[model samples]
Target chain A: MTTAQPLIQARGLVKRFSGFTAVNAIDVAVRAGEAFGFLGPNGAGKSSTMRMIGCVSPPSGGELRILGMDPVRDGPAIRARLGVCPQLDTLDPELTVRENLITYARYFGIPRRVARLRAAELLDFVQLSERADSKVEPLSGGMKRRLTIARALVNEPEIVLLDEPTTGLDPQARHLVWERLFQLKQQGVTLVLTTHYMDEAEQLCDRLVVMDGGRIVAEGSPRVLIEQHSTREVVELRFAGESQEPFVSKLEQLGERVEVLPDRILLYVPDGDAAVVEVTALGLHPLNVLVRRSGLEDVFLHLTGRTLID
Target chain B: MTQLAARRARPGPARVPALAVLQYHLVGYRRTWRGGALSSFLLPTLTVLGFGVGVGAYIDQGVDGVSYLEWIVGGLLASTALQVAIAESTWPVYSSLQWTKIYFAQHAAPLRVADIVAGQLAFVLLRVLTSAAVFLLVTGVLGALRSPWAVLALPVAALLGLAVAAPTFAYAATASSDSWLALLFRFAVIPMTLFAGVFFPVESLPVGLRWLAYATPLWHAVDLSRAATLGTAPVWSVTGHLLYLAAWAAGGWLLAHRALRRRLVV
Candidate 1:
């Protein structure tokens, strides 16, 4: 690595809400010009961690330094250089789409003329120029999310923090947002994001940490985490049954590991086709069988338990 | 990096942080000011015409040796300021804090909680001042201005605005829902307007109620405002009235600061 200092540094960071510990001690470091991610299920304290990093929530313990300044005291200065897009849309309902950008820019002390030009530029960037004069309440969800993202870029912030950027969008809208975020990454803006979608992590994060129960269970590049936690390939078997538990013991020795779900059985092995052959030799006639490469989803299942997290 | 270079080269002016947040309120008002304008001008005009001039002709000897029309004008000015301040404070402040959550968005920016509160409170004061100015003119046109000191009522009205608006800001920030806000107006604001020397002198009330009125911010504002228009001495010393109003503002600001931080910083 180069001698450049990390943009954000945290050691044993903790956040508590009343008597409950939402975020337990966690360590993290985000370097400049690289995309970092927090991958977790809901209630994993990823948003709490992002809130502390955003300087809106004070840490209950440990140390946090964003841009080499204490977030507790130097919040305004740190926030001046940071842009945040929260999970929910918080756009101003009174103003038009374009006015939202201009007014938000002024919060950074941007001059009105500069603010106006930057707003127009950002509107074009987000492809919301045609709806510049429209009220915020009437925009579609995807449009509003894009506008919020544009608002986050009003100051051309050094770092952009996105908390589940595309959690509730359709596939087309998700791709559009993902594509825009990818372009920002290519432009060398440091991006810190949190998501439950393994595909999102794989698509955008150069490096990431998996959080479970307010703790970082694993941290590495996406490929590295997948490689360390899962096999090269997976064999998925779906039999004609409501539950796949009955076939678990029968297929246990055919692969490195066998996992049974509500509808399917997953076999972790070096070669998925060889595992399927072994399954056939075991006198198991499956209704459906498919071979696929292991992904971050499998890695998360291996790290966390099998019980579903909503 | 190029964007950073361009920003440095531009070398923008030193920005006052509160003014930046206030710009949002101002921009929003540009679209909604028409609705507010109608109420500020029309409320006092109708009250003066129907209640002041139209009804004063029936009071046998008038009030305190002056025409009843001129007698109630100053109190009405104070009342108008209180109404304007509270109107701007309750629903809009609660909306920004909870419903729209625009204040949370502002909190995410490079602004302190003080800046957000001060900026919006300043806008409320502006509303109070402009509405008071219009009220002064409407009453003046209807033969209510008896002395040159009548203009002082504008500043007195703004002070009263801060006295009421700041505390209401705290309530809005901390309230769980608009139902609490409805109860506040029904219990607090309505009672103050009726009992605090706005429609009649507090001295005419029972001793217990009179003392209660004396403790209200509106009573101090009304007394000072009456002295301003009638060229008469206020019931309390000028410094005492000013101090009482200023103390409420300071205390309310502290409460609002705490309330806003609690709501937004979490």
Candidate 2:
């Protein structure tokens, strides 16, 4: 509830497993009622960081505080006030969809009658009320994910930790999940999530950290990151050729920077139309051309030297 | 309850919130209880009919001054508790830890690793008590129960469950594969149940094998339960049997807590 102090604060946080360090010393802070994110590719230690924040995995080094309380000493107290939706569903297969929520609520010591009401409300909120009695085994991946998200809210937690909220869902399912998450944000629930999808981070995060190889590489609002790291517009040139390598040198002087991919050449420029005009004046003909505004994907690519998805 | 309140006041690793975990398991048990109920009732009935009536026809002289039905019935009740306890501790514990990952789910909440382990062990004891109570009732109807002290077998059965479950929970938590459980049942559990003086006197075995049986938790449970049912416990070293069973229960719980912490808290 306090704005001056962050709900979660970590300084030089580290997580080491046996001989390998999954998360190197990193600093992070998440204030109340804001949606924060950790965005990165696989093996980037995003999940490990999320696990540490959820208080399930102990930090091998550094200091962590949740609700201004030490993680090691006040884990249960802190966890009681936090909701965690793990990367996997972890739903009980034997219990019905409703029972999953109710049972999880009971773990937090919610009274039976109150738990029943909350389960019903969450079922409706997740749009799973129709299938409330059905076993979780029959639900689709999207439905299960939504139920997981719903389950996370059962405690009416001060902060919700979502690890890869929508990794495997189809576009429509992902949109529905995003919409519900947006609703939670509108209701002023603090959310910290991890995801590899640039669009998901762009869509949901108020501020995010870009992680790679157990360290924070960059941190900012998506717009600020894009503005700072990438150009305003981009022109993608795909030629009917065996390789895009030769065209990269020819297109270099036309834009601020040129990146060559297997199938296309991207020109980062202040203006897409000017870049396209320059490309045309160079006497190089492209099979197809696309001019678009820059996004977080471009920022990630610009900062990390790799495509966000690949 | 006071311990829980005290933990809530100043929570740490030394004290885990247990009631919440117990409530979670109770909710999970709601749907699965029916299947467990059938086995709890049917296994005892069949064992009594098959081993008590069919096998008892051959032995005119009861083994311990009682009918063969009465002698074996008490042992069967104790073994029933052991079976229920081990069954709950093995596949269900493994499935919760590995397959369903329910333990991880609880770990994400206010519950600690110790709470999850203790709550599950308590649930196993609840199940063992239920099955043993039903088996005791059947034994009574069959005229196998001889003394008023037979009522004490219910709690004794729960103690047996604790003895078996603590160690089995630890093993299941640490096992890497479900196949290991099959091997455990075949080599360890089945052998213990068969030769733990359940069907015949352990004295009939060779001296070395008899001492080996004496070391098992199930043998102690059977010995104590049979004595209680037949009013023969006062004649033996009852304190020693109770102490031995208590040792297994206490030691098993500590080992199980460590194993669960290794698996879930990490």
Number of the predicted model whose lDDT against the real structure is largest: 1
Candidate 1's displacement at residue A39, Å, is: 0.6
Estimate the TM-score of every prediction.
0.96, 0.95
| lDDT digits (tens) for residues A1-310 of candidate 1 | 4538899999999999998998899999999999999999999999999999999999999999998999999998889888899999889977999999988988888877777888898889888999999999988889999999999988888899999999999889999899889999999999999999999999999999999989898999999998999999999999986778889998888888887778898999999998888888889999999999999999999888643433
Model 1 docking tier (incorrect/acceptable/medium/high) = medium
Where in model 1 is the C-alpha error above 4 Å?
Answer: A1-3, A306-310, B1-14
B140-210: candidate 2 lDDT, tens digit per residue: 88788888799988888988889889999999999999998888889878899999899999989999999
iRMSD per prediction, in order: 3.0, 5.6
Candidate 2 lDDT over A194-306, as tens digits, reads 99999999999999999988989899999999988899999999998799998888888888888777888889999999888888899989999999999888887777784
lDDT of 1 at A53: 96
lDDT values, one for every candidate: 0.90, 0.86
Q: What DockQ does every candidate get?
A: 0.57, 0.45
Q: Report the lDDT tens digits of candidate 1 across residue range B170-241.
A: 998888989998998898889999999988889999999999999999999999999999888988899999
